[model samples]
Target: MDRITKLTSEKPVIIFSKSSCCMCHTIKTLFNGFGVNPNVHELDEIPGGREVEQALLRIGCNPSVPAVFIGGELVGGANEVMSLHLSRSLIPMLKKAGALWV
Candidate 1:
């Protein structure tokens, strides 16, 4: 939990992902499309990844991968992100987080 907080604190947008998760890929692509250069941590490829994943689970990420933090806050997974996008709230959130300028 503390580790997750530290990681997220360093960036405007952060994504905790698994290398082979398609949904993770989609979410990352979505952020990139919005011109938000999110800091991506591929949990499957990093040391202590499983522990980080467990921490994510404790924080209420069901599937665990693709956990997104915007301005150091959890914005949830693909579904929540897509919902925000469909509601036209995602762009404004990104802008407010300083992840996107336009």
Candidate 2:
């Protein structure tokens, strides 16, 4: 949890992902398309991936890749992100989180 906390606090947009996950890639691409360079943490490449997965679950998320966080708060998975984006709610969240300047 400490590592997760540190990451979320340090970056306006942090994506907990797995390098081999297609959904993770899609989410990253989505952010890129939106002109936001999110801080990506490739869990499978990290040392404490399992622990981190457990930690995410403890916070009520399923053990899934591309767990998005903005302004130090969990924003759910890719589908949630897509929903937000489609609803036009994503930009405001990004701006509020300081992940977008324009």
Candidate 3:
């Protein structure tokens, strides 16, 4: 909750991820491809990770990993990200969030 908020606020784009989740990898790659240097927290490898994961769950992230925050707001998981991309809304959002320069 508070911790998540704090973490999300520290960056223009933030991705809460797991080290081995393929979907997480894909989402990260997508952001990188767009030139957005998101702050990534590998929950599986960090201290208090399980508790952070639980917090994510309580906040409505079903699978939890790959939770993305853009401009300090949750943009959801892989599916949502891909949907936004397909709709051509992702890059604009990234630009608005100051995550992308172009």
Candidate 4:
């Protein structure tokens, strides 16, 4: 169990992504910019990371590179993430997950 898995299985916010993914990098940067520490998993490195992969797959996700999971819930791809951000809902959701500071 790596840091990401441990965090996902325990923490409130988890992001599974690949190193080459711009969306992954971007979302992470945004969280960091907000002074938030989000747990990250890079599927490109882990073997049999399919549980997370399959979870995303069930939602008709097109392997767009980065998958965001909140409180062990799959929140969808980058666009969904961006949508939440634009609506100012992401931070509130994070707070609900206890993943954000007050």
Q: Largest TM-score belongs to which candidate? A: 1
lDDT of 3 by residue, 1-102 (tens): 899999999999999999999999999999998878999999999998899999999999989989999999999999999999999999999999898886
Query: What lDDT is reached at residue 80 by model 1?
Result: 92
What are the lDDT figures for the candidates, one per model? 0.95, 0.90, 0.94, 0.76
Structure candidate 3, residue pairs in collision = none
lDDT of 1 by residue, 20-75 (tens): 99999999999999899999999999999999999999999988988999999999
* TM-score (C-alpha) between model 1 and the true structure: 0.98
- Candidate 4: segments with Cα more than 4 A from true spot: 1-7, 50-55
lDDT score of model 4? 0.76
Worst ten-residue run, lDDT, model 1?
93-102
Clashing pairs in 4: none
For each candidate in turn, give its C-alpha RMSD to the true structure in angstroms: 0.5, 1.0, 0.6, 3.4
Window of ten residues with lowest summed lDDT in model 2? 57-66
Name the top lDDT candidate: 1
Better of 1 and 2 by TM-score: 1
Each prediction's number of clashing residue pairs:
0, 0, 0, 0
lDDT over C-alpha atoms for residue 91 of model 2: 95
